[model samples]
Target: MNETISNSPHQWNTQELPVVVIAGYGPSIGESTARQFGSKGYAIACLGRTQNKLLDSVQELKASKITAAAFVTDCGDTRSVKEAIQQVQSHLGRISVIVWNAASYVGSDLVTGNDDPSEILNQIVGVGCAGLLASIQEAYEDLKAMKGTILITGGGLSGYDQNVNQIAVNNSWMGLAFCKSSQRKLAGLLHARLKPDGVMVGTVIISGAVRVGGGLDVTDPDDVATAFWEIHHSRHKQEVHLGSLTQLASEPT
Candidate 1:
């Protein structure tokens, strides 16, 4: 595993690079996080549902010395996640890290007095839990061999704030809230169980909306990326909260 980077952050060159598989990647914090790792000589694999957005992100990262690729992935599906990880390993050498940043924005039919109990269960389990399990299973050997980490992006809606959860309940955002809460729990559980096996698990609770456009200007994407980098660098701690927000998705960035 040899890598070289010039004094310039953009001049990264590597032969055998560890792969950071970012699931649920998008144009905002996901892209920034990719660059943050790319600048550090890690090859990046951005897995998302949108092909065009992933390509755009790849272009942005390639502007530097980073080796990046776009994989159209449905992180909500176990098969898709497994296949994506396989593709990443085949392309980027090995799976060194996983960034779980995807979620379903579907209305909580269960909370809103409608019933899609089965679908909701599948979504929550598939995207945030079972899907992650599949991802880990696919790369577990490599990750354990490399002593890598699983970083989850979660925040206020993880049953942390009664007001936020209540607002989500009121607004039928219970689905996303459920995802956040489950992911928070997942991070803790994985942290405890995987630590002995050389894998680190951590979650960043972004209290503010990601600074992408007109909302949550307080949470800069690069800052969020830095927080992830720092957590990975420290290689300990189960979770960290970033930024400040009075409400969840209500205050308009």
Candidate 2:
């Protein structure tokens, strides 16, 4: 095996670039994260359910002269997640970072409840929790070797759901809050287990509405991506809250 040695930490351009796997590759944080890491010279492997979406992202990354590839898989399925991980390893080498950004938001009314609560919960658990578990399991060895990081996209509703005022204002957000709350807990659990093994696990909680175009308080996906990279680079924070509500002196009780 041949390895490049660098006396200075700043000398990374000469070494083999690390790989970043962006699961649930979409136009929002997924795409931005890919571009952010890719611009830094890391190989990008995008995983998404839609081939067209993945291909478009890959093409855009390639156009920018970044090494990029895409894998199509349903993140909600463990078998599919494993298969995609294997393919990513085969095509892009060991992953140095894993970004879990997939979630199912069916807009199910929590007051009346969905026609099938089981299905909604299943989907939520599958994407928000199960998929993250499977990816970490498959990437553990590689991540441990590289002392890598896992960044999760969390929602503000998770923390806000407990607030009486927030709940009174929008009862429909309960289902999303439940799933996001679970995901945040899962990230914390993973951080506790993996920190000793040199894997950094963190989640960025967006405390306001996220949209392409919105008010000053709305969370921007690009900013969220930058925050993800900053957390990974620092490896010092377990969680970060974005937007007005979270940036306030007191973020929900």
The 10-residue segment of model 2 with minimum total lDDT is 1-10
Model 2, residue 151: distance off in Å is 0.2
- Candidate 1 on 60-178: residue-level lDDT in tens? 78877678877888888888888888877866677888988888776564645565788777777678788788888999999899999898888777866677766676666777778
Q: Which candidate should be chosen as best, given lDDT against the real structure?
A: 2
In candidate 1, position 170 carries an lDDT of 66
Rate residue 206 of model 1 by lDDT: 76
In model 2, what lDDT does residue 227 have? 91
Worst 10 residues of 1 by lDDT: 1-10
Tens-digit per-residue lDDT, 148-232, candidate 2:
9999999877774346236523545556677788898899899999999999999998876677654666888888888999999
lDDT for every model?
Answer: 0.77, 0.78
Flag regions of model 2 displaced more than 4 Å. Answer: 1-16, 111-114, 164-171, 212-214, 245-253
